[model samples]
Target: MKMQAEVIREGELEKRSDSLFQLWKKKLVVLTKDSLSLFPDGHKRAKGKELGFGSILKVDCVERTGKYIYFTIVTKDRKEIDFRCPDQSCWNASITMALIDFQNKRAIQDFKSRQEMEQAAGKR
Candidate 1:
């Protein structure tokens, strides 16, 4: 529990606001993952296996303009991400598909965890 709390606190990056999404369209979300639950659909689209921390981002998208792809990050306080990568055509669709699956799985797991906790409390 302590480790999980520490990880959540450390792993999070501040959320960007609606205005930044309006201005830029989308942003990439990365995971410092050791292993990701592989997705079948996404597996078909992969150019190659992502190795270690070399996986630049798990997903990328442009938010506002129908997801016209770009690379930038602007926090809610209007802080700009100075970091830039070489212009590359990102595989948005595949990444998006995989991320959706990941999120659904997480949601289910969270619900189950809550149920178990509630059951324990009732028994107590």
Candidate 2:
């Protein structure tokens, strides 16, 4: 499937799995205007996992210990996805900015819709 939005950034990052062991998997991460996509190494047919901005509630920078910076992406469903990468990569900041932009656009659209509804109600 083709993505309609432009890709903001693409790189590899260590994703912390939700399993009991909390294993870190190295996956290729692609950040677009609408979603984040993950792909396995050299995988051609797999679509991998896509996390849309609408389902993402917030992005949090948890801590920075030595070489790696820790961050978490919290979904609207209350699920937390953890990630850590090299201090120089700046993956955490990039993702946070993109998510914020998407959220702000969504908020503006919601406000406009609500205003239109209120005006229609007043007219009736």
Candidate 3:
């Protein structure tokens, strides 16, 4: 069964390459409630890299220029990925909000599980 994730936003953003040249390339980004998918080309049908919210530590706004707002996404493995979008686009805020919502949902689930374990222990 394929899981359908709700789309929060979709737009084009420039991502800094990790290669030696560190060139910035425009990517087609699809922000979902649970993950951010980056398509190299404009075609969404192509294979893309999916960054699950579970592995995202935080999204930090690094700087803002007249043309673009720069941000970094820190992952669980401490890898930082840089991205930039037009200042008016507010991509940083969108990603941060989505990340917060995902984290809150995980926290709530953890709390409920702990409560259930406590109740079981009391019964025992």
Q: Identify the leading candidate in terms of lDDT.
A: 3
Alpha-carbon local distance difference test for all models: 0.36, 0.88, 0.95
Best first by TM-score, ranked: 3, 2, 1
Q: Which candidate ranks first by TM-score, i.e. highest? A: 3
lDDT of 2 by residue, 32-117 (tens): 98888888772525777989999999888679989999999999998889999898999988998999999999999999999999
How does candidate 1 score on lDDT? 0.36
What does the lDDT read for residue 1 in candidate 3? Answer: 94
| Model 2 lDDT-worst window of ten | 39-48
**Ranking under lDDT, best-scoring first?**
3, 2, 1
Model 2 TM-score, all chains together: 0.88
**Can you write out model 1's per-residue Cα lDDT over 6-108, one digit (the tens) per residue?**
1101111223334645432122334322322222223324342222222223443343334234433333344343222223434334334544555566779
Candidate 2: stretches off by over 4 Å: 1-3, 42-44
Specify the poorest-scoring 10-residue window by lDDT in model 1.
4-13
TM-score of each: 0.35, 0.88, 0.97
Model 1 stretches with alpha carbons more than 4 Å out: 1-90
Better of 1 and 3 by lDDT: 3
Residue 100, model 1, lDDT? 56
